[model samples]
Target chain A: MDSIFAIPLISAIVSIAGNLAVFRKASFLIAGVAHSALAGVALAIFLASISIELDYFLVATLFAIFFALLATTFSKFSDIDTGIGVSFALAMAIAVILISLTRGYTAKLWAFLFGELFLMTEKDFLYISIALVAILLIFGFFYDKLIFFLFDPEGAEASGINTRLIDAIVVAIVAIAVVAVIRAVGAILAYSIFVAPSAVAKKFSKSVAQSLIYSFLITLICLILGLIVSSAIPISASAISAFIASIIYLLVAIEKS
Target chain B: MAIEAKDLSYSYGKTIALENLSFKIDDGEIIAILGPNGAGKTTLLKCILGLLRANGEISVLGRDPRKDKKVLNMISYVPQRSSLSIDLPIKVLDVLKMTCKEIDSEILRHLELENKLDLLFRELSGGFQQRVLIARALMKRPKVLLLDEPFNGVDVLSQKRIVEVLERSGATTLVVVHNINPVLHAVHRVMLLNKKLVAFGKANEVFRRENMVKVYGAEIPLVVCEEGVVHPLYGDQHG
Candidate 1:
C-alpha cells in the first residue's frame, strides 16, 4: 500500500525472477557483482568529495556491470570458471576498506555494505519499480529460450539459438538486478534472496515454470515476514529476510528427507 | 551436395583435432563416420554444424555455415549423451515443444515414447534419453541431420529402431559411431577417420583389413554375414 513497502516487494520480485532465469549458479555471479559494487561506491564517494557531483547509483551500476561482464567474459575466453572472477570482489572489498579508513567515511561504506531499507527515498522506489518491470518483460519474452539454454546449452545452440548473446544478456540482467536492490538488501545479504528462495522452489517443483512461481511466492513470504519481525524488534530487515530464506530452505530439505 | 568441406582443419590450441579433412554428402544420403577415440569424429561434426571455428571452408545447403546462420535452421544436431545433463528438471514433451513448433505424433508413436511425454527426462533410461534426443532432432524436419554417438548407451532394440527410423527419414544424415556394425546395413556409405580421412565409400569398400587396422591401430577381423561385414572389434562389444 505505502511506497515504503514497495521497496521490499520489488526487491523480492527481482530476486525471484533473476534467480529463475539463471538458477542457483547465478548467486555466485551476484555475489561477485554485488561485492564489486563497493569499488564503484568508493570511486563515487571520492569523486563527490572533490565536488564532481555524480550520481552514486549510476557509478555503482556501471562499475558493477563492468566487473560482472569482465568476470563472465574472462571465464569464457580462458580455461577458468566464474569462481576465478570472484577475485574482483575480494580486490574491491580491500579497496573499499582502505578508502573508507583514509577518507573517514566508514559509516557511509557501512550503509552500502549492510543496507538501510528504511532510508529508501522516493527516487530509490522509482528505480526499483523500473528495474522490476524491465526484469519481468525480459524474462517473459526470453523465458522459453532461457529455459532451453539452461537445460541444454549444446542443444540450444544447435537449434540456431544465439547462446553467447543470450548468456551475455543473462549476465546483464543479473548485474541490473543486483544494482537495483543493493541498497535495500545490501551487497552481502542480496545473494541469499537470489539463491535461497530458488533452492527451496527447486526441491518442491517438477518444472521450470512451477519453480519460478514457487520461488516468487517463497521470496514474497520471506520478505513480508522479515518486515513484520524487524518492525517489532531491533534487527536488520535484510538480515531477517536472509534468515527466513535459510530457515525455509532447511525446512524444505527436511521435508524432502 | 547437401554438405561439403574442403581442407577443413581444426585444432585445440596446439593439438590438432582434424587436419585437411574433406568430404561431401549427397542429398538424402545416410553416411556413418567411424573412428577410434580422439580421431576428431565429433570435431568434424561440430565444424559442419558451425559450432567450431575451422581453418578451411564448410558449406551446408550452398551457404557457409560459419558465416550464415540460416543454414542452421534446416539442420538438426544430436550431440553425444555426455553433452546433456539428465538431472535437469524438464519434461520430455517440454524439450520437444521448445525445439519444435509442433510435435510429430508419428515419430513419438514410432519411438514408443508417446506414453512417457510427461515424465521427467532424468527419469528415463539411457536408451530412452537417446530416443528422446533423436525425436527432438526429428521434430524439426531438418534437411540435414547430424548425430554424434547416437548409440552410445542405447539398448539393442532401440538401436534397431533408430537405424530403421533414419533409414526411412530420407534426410541427409551423418552419424558418428564408435562401432560400425549396427548401422552398416542402414548407412549408404561409411567414412573412416583417424585425424584424417582414411576411407570413404560403401561399407564393404571401407571396412577392409588395412583400413580398419589404420584407423583402429589393430587387426580387426571382419565376418561377412547375411546383413553385412561385421567388424568383430566393435560389433561384439555391445552385443
Candidate 2:
C-alpha cells in the first residue's frame, strides 16, 4: 500500500523480467503484451459500468498470456518481429473499441496510463509480492537450462531439454510480468522498466549474472530517483522514472558508439 | 545398424526438402552428409534427432526416434556455428556444463578450449566457437552425435582438431558439412545430396566426377593424394 516499499518491489520484478526479455530478444513482444493488457483493463471497466464485477489484473493476465502465445503461433507463419507487431496493432484496436464503449472511463484510463502507485491497495502489493517470488523461484531453478535454450535452441532440444516447456515458462513470465508491472506503473512507464535497464546492462555486463545485477541496480536507482524528483516537482513519478530510464539508455548508446 | 531410413521424406508445405531418401549407418561409424545449400543435410539430421516429423520410417539405435522420447537422451547435436546469434554473455563452461554435470576436461583439452572456459561465448573466434559447440556435444557421451556444419568458419587448426576429436569420439556420428574435404580423411562414407540422395558410399566410390556434378551441379576437380585420398576443389557456400 505504501509508495516507498512498492517502488523497490516493482523494480526488482521488472529488472529480472526485463533481463530475460532482452535475452529472449522479446522486448517488443513484452511491450506488445503490456499494450494488450489495456484491452483487458478496458473490458473490465466496461463490465464494471454494466454492474458486472471482474478483476482488471485477472483479465489483463489472461489477455497478455493469450497475446503472447498468439504472437508465437503467428511467428510460425512469419518472422517473430512481424508477428508481434501485428498482434500489438490488433490489441490496440481492441482496446480502443472497448474504451469507446465504456462511460466515465477517463479516471481508470489515467490510472493505467501514468500509474497510481499512491493509490495502490494492500491487495495489489500482495499480488505483486507473490509474482516476484514466483519469478525468482522459476528463473533461479531453470537458469542453466534457460541459458542453453536461449543460446542454441536446436542444440538444447537435441540434448533432451524440454524446449517447449521452456518456451511456455518464458512466455508465461513475460506475460505475467508485463501485466503486473503495468498494473503498478501503467503500460507506458512499465515498458521502460521492462527494457531500458536490461538493454543498458547488456552493454557493460560480462556474463548473465552480472547483467541481472546491473539491471536491478539501474532500475532501483531510476525508481528511487523518480520518486525523489517527483516529490520536489509537480510531475508524476512514473513519468519521471520512464524519462530517467530512457535518458540513461540514450547516454549509454551514445557512449558505446 | 545405428541409423536406418526407409522411404523417409519431408517437405515444407508443398516444397520438397527431402524425398524418398533411405540409408543405413553402421554402429560406431562416422559418416559425412554433403550437399550444396538447401540439400536437406540439416533436415536429415533434424529427422534423426526427432526435431522434425517426416514421412516413412527412421530408426535410430533400433528405435523410432519420433515414437521414443528416450532417444533424445542418446543423441547430441551441434548446430551450425554461424546459425547461432546469441547476445547473452554465456561462457564456454556454461555451454559445456548445460548437458553434463561433470564436463570431460579431456575433451576440452583436446579442443584446446580448456583455458577459454571463462571467456564469453560471443567473444570467441569462429574457430573457437565451433570447437566449443563440438565439445559441448561430446560432453553428453552420446551414442549418436549429430553435427550440422560443425566446421563452418573454423580455422585450419581448429578444423584438424575437430576431425581428430570426432575420430576419437567413437560414437555413431553424422556430420553435415558443405564440403567433405575438411573431414575427408576422418569420415568412412560420404553421402552427397542435393534435394535427394545422389550418392552414399565409401569416399573413394562416392567422390566420382559424375556424383560431384549431379549433386553440386558442376564438375568439382578432384585430386588423388599419395594416400589414395580423393580431395575435391571448389567453393562450398552455406545456404
- Per-residue CA lDDT of model 2 for B41-122, tens digit only, reads 9999999988899998999999998889799888988888655655678878887888887889899999999799999888
Candidate achieving the largest lDDT: 2
TM-score of A-chain in each prediction?
0.87, 0.95
Q: Stretches of candidate 2 above 4 Å error?
A: B235-239
- True-contact fraction per candidate equals 0.69, 0.75
lDDT by residue (A7-124, candidate 1, tens digit) is 5555456555456444525557767777777677777777776667777778777887788777866776663244436657564865566575446566776777877665677777
In TM-score terms, which candidate is top? Answer: 2
Cα lDDT for residue A170, candidate 1? 79
- Supply the DockQ value of model 2: 0.72
Q: Supply the DockQ value of model 1.
A: 0.67
